[model samples]
Target: MTGNPAPAAAYKGPLPRATPETQPFWDGAKAHKLMLPWCEDCGQAHFYPRALCPHCHSVRLAWRQASGRGKVHTFVINHKAARGFEDKVPYVIAVIELEEGPRMMSNLVMDETPTPENVHVEMPVAVVFDDVTPEVTLPKFRPVR
Candidate 1:
């Protein structure tokens, strides 16, 4: 399994991947917006952008703005930190269920420390950004108002 790059505060990780097909997703993140690919054929929303619609294999696709509201589906807390994030141990990593039906993996922020015990599955969250690097901004999540 692959994870997106850790933030600049945790700069030891590689930069997040932004392929030609998925550039728009990251571009929206830079502007602190959540955008995703919508299948023109099936008329549904999807993530981890692809050239064609994953459901119908339709080459014609379009992008739609996301609601940015989701629920935590699954998660783990990194008690043993990675290289760059050694200082911020015990952070919450989550698989969030977007209202539109797609699930995304990201961090839960604005909490003192996010943990499985503290962060429950099915908890509502909203998109937030951490300008981790000058060129990169992470679309993390926090408890939604």
Candidate 2:
């Protein structure tokens, strides 16, 4: 409702650019799913996709859809927003270790604002999406059952 009529979403204020290597990930988001590149040769998953696998340096990576289950590995609760993300002044940014073993950095959401000591290394989490742009969805997290 920012009267200019650009149809901008509230949560996804400004999104970063996506390259060819990241196209697959964005595509999955459109389906309300999270897809990550897995190294079929080495049996591992990784984020920030690249043509070559980070583990074995294998070029034979494949795109696998994830169940989006994970645990918070570490985090920092930001009381002040950064850059264009000022809308989200107070938030928790965390590194989550997915069930499939990929570690991704994302935001943590819940009823109350988080504090560093309130988060733990192995707190169960699940994926949530913030459809910032029409073509892009940013992955966020919430506590799990």
Alpha carbon lDDT of residue 49, candidate 2? 87
Q: For candidate 2, write residues 1-145 as lDDT tens digits.
A: 1112234444535576778998888888767789999998998888878998988999888998898999999888888778766766688889999998889999887766676666777899999886666767678888885
Q: How far in Å is the alpha carbon of 128 misplaced in model 1?
A: 0.2
Give per-model TM-scores: 0.88, 0.86
lDDT of 1 by residue, 1-145 (tens): 0144444554664468789998999998888889999987899888779898888888878888898999999888889887767766878889999999888899888446764557888989998876777787778898775
Candidate 2: TM-score? Answer: 0.86
Worst 10 residues of 2 by lDDT: 1-10
Runs in model 1 with CA error above 4 Å? 1-10
Candidate 2, which segments miss by more than 4 Å at Cα? 1-12
Model 2, residue 111: distance off in Å is: 1.4
